[model samples]
Target: MNREEINKLFGVTDEQLDHMAAEYESGKWEGGVGPIVPGRPRIYDEELETISFRLPKSRVNAIDARAKRNGETRSQFLRQAVDDALLANA
Candidate 1:
């Protein structure tokens, strides 16, 4: 996306994006070159696929609360739960 589009989409200033772009071009930023990955390195050992589905606001709040209580982000909590459930069933 162009600078304006990106700025609009992410609410970043054009100046900040330009600075980041310069840093990335200089190879000073490790994260801007490749496909973006979600989750922290400690939590995710492999590439991740992005997925989305809508849930009720209450359900989202419940999930977020559970994840927070477990010291996990929503995505990490969901991923771990799904993996565990699938393995258990298998």
Candidate 2:
């Protein structure tokens, strides 16, 4: 993908990528570019994927209320709920 597509898909800024490049070029490069990894690092050694589904209006409103009470966005609240559920099953 092009840089613009990459930025949209990976949530990385062009300036950030440029800074990384400058750092790399400043290195010794003794091995001559052995390996390269793009994009930002994942949190908690975990990769997250986005999923979409429809929910009832009432359920959405309830989730929003609880998320607000917990000081989290709807996505964060849902992610934590799923994580908790997975742990419980495990």
Candidate 3:
């Protein structure tokens, strides 16, 4: 859809639409005209670490169900749980 369509659909102000159009004309805007991919936000830093472990099938199933109910993936739910646990301990 075009900018005017998007503006009408999202109720964006005319001024905002004009600014976006100007940015597009100036080649300063680089966003794609597609649905955003969902998941964890990307973090490009050395401080981030990756760890993997295996869980029992029953536990994994339970986690998947809970995560789905909460509108999150298993990884997102686990990450938030870990952060909360650390804060609680602290």
Taking all chains together, each candidate's TM-score versus the true structure is 0.49, 0.51, 0.55
Which stretches of candidate 3 lie above 4 Å from their native place? 1-27, 30-40, 43-46
RMSD of 3: 7.0
Model 3 has a clash total of 0
Candidates 2 and 3 compared by TM-score, better number: 3
Per-residue lDDT of candidate 3, residues 1-90 (tens digit): 997798799999799877988877676765676434456557544567889999999999999999999999988899998999999999
Model 2 stretches astray by more than 4 angstroms = 1-44
Q: Given candidate 3, what's the lDDT at residue 35?
A: 39
Error of 2 at 64 (Å): 0.4
- Model 2, residue 4: C-alpha shift (Å): 43
- The candidate that wins on TM-score is 3
* Model 1 deviation from the true structure expressed as Cα RMSD, one decimal place: 11.2
Candidate 1 residue-wise lDDT, 16-87, digit = tens: 878888876676766646643454445566766889999999999999999999999998798998999999
Overlapping backbone residue pairs in candidate 1 total 0
Spell out the clash pairs found in candidate 2.
none
lDDT of 2 by residue, 1-90 (tens): 887997989888999777777877776333475544556545557666779999999999999999999999998899899999999999
